[model samples]
Target: MTDPLSALEAAVQALPDDRTLRVRYAELLADAGRHGEAIEQASVVLREAPEDEAAKAVVRRAALAAAEPPGSTPAAAPPDDRHEDIDWSELEASIANPTEPPFVERVVAEHDEELVAEAGETAEDADPVAELRRETVRLADVGGLEVVKRRIDESFLQPMAHPEIAAAFGKKLRGGLLLYGPPGCGKTFLARAIAGELGAHFISVTLSDVLDRFIGESEKNIHRVFRTAREHAPAVLFFDEMDAIGAKRSGNTFSSFRNVVNQILVEMDGVDSQNDGVYVLAATNHPWEVDAALKRPGRFDRMVLVRPPDDDAREAILRVHLRRRPIEGIDLGDLVRRTKGFSGADLEHLVTTAAEKAMTESIRTGSVRPMRMDDMRAALKEVKPSIGPWVQTARNVAEYSNGSGEYDDMVEWLREEKQL
Candidate 1:
């Protein structure tokens, strides 16, 4: 047989710059265990057409093929109706290109309607957590929420790192975790960081994403969310502000929301531990608003509270927010003490407003200078905590404590500051 490297070189030389031909050549090279050459060819194609869907599809296929055990055959092609592995841009081009061949044209015609409709719906109702997860930033990028971070590492990250240990004990590795706290307390940031830690594809679903005007479409969308997660196993499925769809059904409430919640419960319960390598993580400010059924043992079994920052956390948050800026005579420790009730988000806004004020002063005086202590102090006076209402609501839900005994430090701080 001819060497795969020689075959690839000949193919590339014959159809240089042709994205499709290059992709096919790369795949064949990968199958023949010439990974370096295949990667180089794929890289060249990607550089030329950064948004080339066909090229990306080829790269994914080739990488999977190259990773297979020696003598093992490549996996079968995914079903035609499945959009999970479809090259979205290639599908679009096929639909738009008038001169495409008959078979290609027929496939496009058959799938385009459903695909386009689904895409349109998804675009219209994009989940905020899903959007956040796409960025996939390291844990260091997020400021504050250290306690929550440790809990996440202990719960999700540790299990992911040692899946065999978890599996050997007959524990279910796939399930959901609930992060409940005030908004902007870094719940979404932790979710993204978890995805980064696990190296998993993250898909965010929301109440708006699944809810629809059509009678049965809402349930169908819920099914699609889990189905997509299963297709992309070892994936993180995040639901932000879960209260919207996860609210417990009350006697006087509308039946539509109830049905949607029921559908979600059923789908979540049906996820098999072995087959579906999915991790569902949800964030909500109002844990009280979540349906009782959803919070039960089998569904979102683990609930981690991401509360407002403590003194040390606040100081850390301040330092991170001020890292890029030029500041003078600012005592972060004192600032942390003063901002007793401030959330991580509140501190960020405080820093931003302070910088703006300093810039305005500099422009007025015609002198470019770093922010002064007065600028930050003035901003602190104006930027009040946004979590007061949520705090009271949380206190009203169940009790002021879950008896974890870890929040004594925060409680003591609140007492010292006379904010409890």
Candidate 2:
């Protein structure tokens, strides 16, 4: 058709109540410079489905485009949405611009409006674990970390997945384990993997997901989170960025903060409360900041240190990012060798930066060109591993906090890696 937008507009007129088709129509309208109409169409969906984060994104972009100069380019939409790929930008970056405000957050959409009408699962809610979308993230999906996977299988995953064996072996089926590592080292990703491994619903709570201002609200949130998991037996409730909520209370004297940590302890105690099938998973970039009480037994007792990915894992990560994009036969081995210290997140950015350069070339020549090795080589120069400072901070913690041997795993790792 000569005018796809016009044809789509007519189709929308025919099926005005078709929200799905309207969504498609709105995308075309935004592309056709009709931001106002696009905004209206997207708002209709939002009113009907408030939890649709992508619909919210469409509205935000339409509003931004309407306010900007005519013919100005809109920010790039997040990549790899059609598949089960990671868009750190959408999960953590903004669509209006990667650097801009109101970042697109990942909210697991509800399949049936009346069946379970809630934003996300909480520790308090009866079915809190049922709220988050459950994906099949196998351990194989994790690029590297054979050792970490084995450790988790023994200490965390196998126990939860096989309760009969756990009970027979005098092991506790329901308990918490902590995943501590540098940022973007795939703690959240591993949590999802555990959920997939167990074939259970997953509820992941971040600092942004749970903190409250008024007195007792945060504690209430914590109880609700655990209760939700308990209600949905065989569920995984992951607390991300745990340091923010469970920071050490010794040097710092914030009564409210201490209360939150105490509440976590109470909820994790399966003796008073029957927590048979619920699995508690938590992750932190700054383990030292986490309250020592949280590290005790029956709580987040077992700690798995998620170090930087090995060469194979890094190569696997690079392949996933490059899979959907237009690219020539780039050398994955050479890329892996050269980018020795690159984290998964860094590799994602490296591929994105490379793709952006190829896109710029396409725009310049009016013809699409596949990404080349040179584009990647240039991007490699721009992106560096962002893990040095985090590891250094962890080293300091190991140095000062070894009296209790709580950080012995970290100390041993630093020693082996010669990072001490």
Candidate 3:
């Protein structure tokens, strides 16, 4: 029998410099246990035809071959490593056997669900909603909202569990709670965490999914949101960025949007006093933009403020994001202090950008190690904080915060910092 490596070598020697031939040659080399040569040849092909799917396919195949156990047999390698030659057999087998999807796929899938639910699909159709609802926000992931979480658990979650006891006195179970804060401050994430703690379905709705080009479509979408909630009773309906559809209607604007806002007001009001076991959770960066009628007593009675992370919260954010990364002798407390006024999202980005910078530097210097403090400091120079603009808008809105009025703290913080 002919040796596979010898056959592969002969094949590579026979091939021309054409992109397709090079790709095939690389695949055969990889399958024949010559990964180093395969990688080198694939790299050349990729540099020449960066956008060639066939070339990229060969690179991926070469990578997997290099990763395989030393003694494991290589699978059949395609001549032209294109999508046409994708090992459907392997993919289908994995899907049937059920291994975890790649990390990128998982993240992309989660984001896709988020985008869909935000457009206002029923909770039942949005499977990711259920998954998000199951994600409990550990005190660590929440950053610096200790006081807020304590109040919420004590005031809302605990009370709702024992509604009969509350009713025996004078208190009744509330239908909804609204969380308003600056963008990227973790409002959506907090709502998901709440749903997780409650062991309920998290249905996230947004204006994009509900609003329609056709007349009367918006109202119908609104009905569908509520109707689905009723069907999946005892679920949490989380409306993110509610201002888009729930905005206060100016007398000068088109009546169509005004009517939709009015319909939301009516539905929210209708849900009150009804113990159908459905809980309404809403969040917005622009609370002042919401309709006055919707903020009335019966609609969204309990409003919570989800402000940017304070110093302590920033530390927590840094820790959470850096958990899986390689770090040595890094002072988290110092980072937090230096990153005052940063949001949870900002901290995550800071860590990621720093790691990327370090990786690039390592590649250049032939170093295979985690990023150091100097690399992080360099990234900080490039990644500015996003909270400044948010704090200003929050202050302006706080001045007019009539209902619940919980955003006063955020406003005060901004004022003290002279950022408002």
Candidate 4:
């Protein structure tokens, strides 16, 4: 006689709408220790007929079984059969009202009352610098971009490391450093590495961390960020997307935005030039969009261009992304050669696409398979280099707006790459 579970699986495959068959199959899968498959089967039933008690019970039991640690006997289902793995409350609420939005689309709640550090303190009043952390990544962790690294070392790291030598030579370990490059080129990562090299705490601030809906709140947030860094002396306060926060005052329509920019200018200089130990680092994809005042002397005067990863960096990125996934016969050197001009993010997407293709094949064949070279080749065809438009824009800027020799380095790079 044909095995009952196998027959049911085949039957369900043929008639997928058979709710009764799927529930029974799910139960059998749970009994056989295939809890993941069992939960999937039961979830399908719940989606269609959410009030189905039997399907709900199966899901609860299977989810609980799946959460159990290996080598431990499965515990009996409790009266409520609630499992922490799945949000049962949210699932039931969604089932009750199908019009409700999914969890991903739901808005996160505002900062809670407990986030108030003191009585009568509002959300905006809270210290926005709570995310300060010690960075372990150094320049060595960064694979390529030798030119960018060298610029950082000579300009920032070396001076801080040998302060005595720098003072002797009349070099000040002050002034903001602005890193301009295409997006996902590891500017933020490099900033963190610089902080680590200095053995300082890293505090990264983005647009959301500074911008507020209320008037005067945005400027307050900016002050808070600098104040936090000052309190934690020898800290690196990194602004991830400086263009958004320090947009050109002339271009901004809102007075509030101009005020925010003015506040940033004031804070960067610090009160009585007390910003000795607080290192300010900012990154922007569009340096041309940043306010000219912010880039003036005594501000973000020093600038570095972080271009896309080279061959070695691309290979390192691919290896990192694919380390956990099962892969076969992948030529790292060939991949690196082919992925020229690809950013770190683009390489990660390529790996993800290849893994997804392998997974789809595995699902269709009912057997797990490793990502192969063919999968990677197919993925490469689909995922083109995303840095083309950025490069073109940079080239145009280098050509037209580089009268002051500001973007001379970019001009040199464009000519070197024959993109000019």
What lDDT would candidate 2 get against the real structure? 0.75
Query: On lDDT, who's better, 1 or 4?
Result: 4
140-259 per-residue lDDT for model 1 (tens digits): 666666666787788767876687998898776676788877787788778877877777778877666766433344566676777677767778888888987687777313334566
Q: Write the per-residue lDDT of candidate 4 for residues 1-420, one digit (tens) a residue.
A: 999889999999999999999999988988888776776687667545645778777755665566567798998666564555766645442332122212112222355456674446655456754579999999999998899999999987877888789789986666589999888889999999999999999999988787753335567778888888887878999998899889898875344467778888989875655787788999999999999999998899889999899877887899999999999999998899989889899999999999999999999999999999999999999999898999999989997998988888888888988999
Better of 3 and 4 by lDDT: 4
Model 1 TM-score (2 dp): 0.63
Give a tens-digit lDDT track for model 3, residues 1-420: 997656655666776466676777777776666665665676566444435666555545655655567689766565654568566435422322112222111124666667668969643234322222345554345666886788678767887778689789866554678888777888888888777776677678876667543334456567667766666657777887878767777631333466678667767665442435677888988777777777777677677777677777787778878889887777877787778777778888899999998788779999867877877788789888886776666766667653565566666666777766
- The all-Cα superposition gives candidate 2 an RMSD in Å to the true structure of 16.2
Task: Give the TM-score ranking, best first.
Answer: 4, 2, 3, 1
> What CA root-mean-square deviation does each model show from the true structure?
18.0, 16.2, 18.0, 18.0
Tell me how candidate 1 scores on lDDT.
0.69
TM-score of 3: 0.63
Residue pairs with colliding backbones in model 3 are 119-209, 144-313
Candidate 3 wrong stretches, greater than 4 Å: 1-141, 170-174, 271-275, 398-407, 415-420
| Model 1 ranges with Cα > 4 A deviation | 1-111, 114-144, 271-275, 398-420
Q: What is the lDDT of every predicted structure here?
A: 0.69, 0.75, 0.67, 0.81
Model 3 lDDT, full chain set = 0.67
Per-residue lDDT of model 2, residues 1-420, tens digit only:
468887888988998878888888878777777876776677566545545666656665565666566577665554435334644334322332222222122244445333354645332232332257676888888988888899899978766777787789898667788999889889989999988998887988876455542234556678777777776778888888898878776643334456678778888873577777788888999887888888887788899988788888998899999999999979988999988877889889999999999999999999999999999999988988888998888888888867888678778778977989
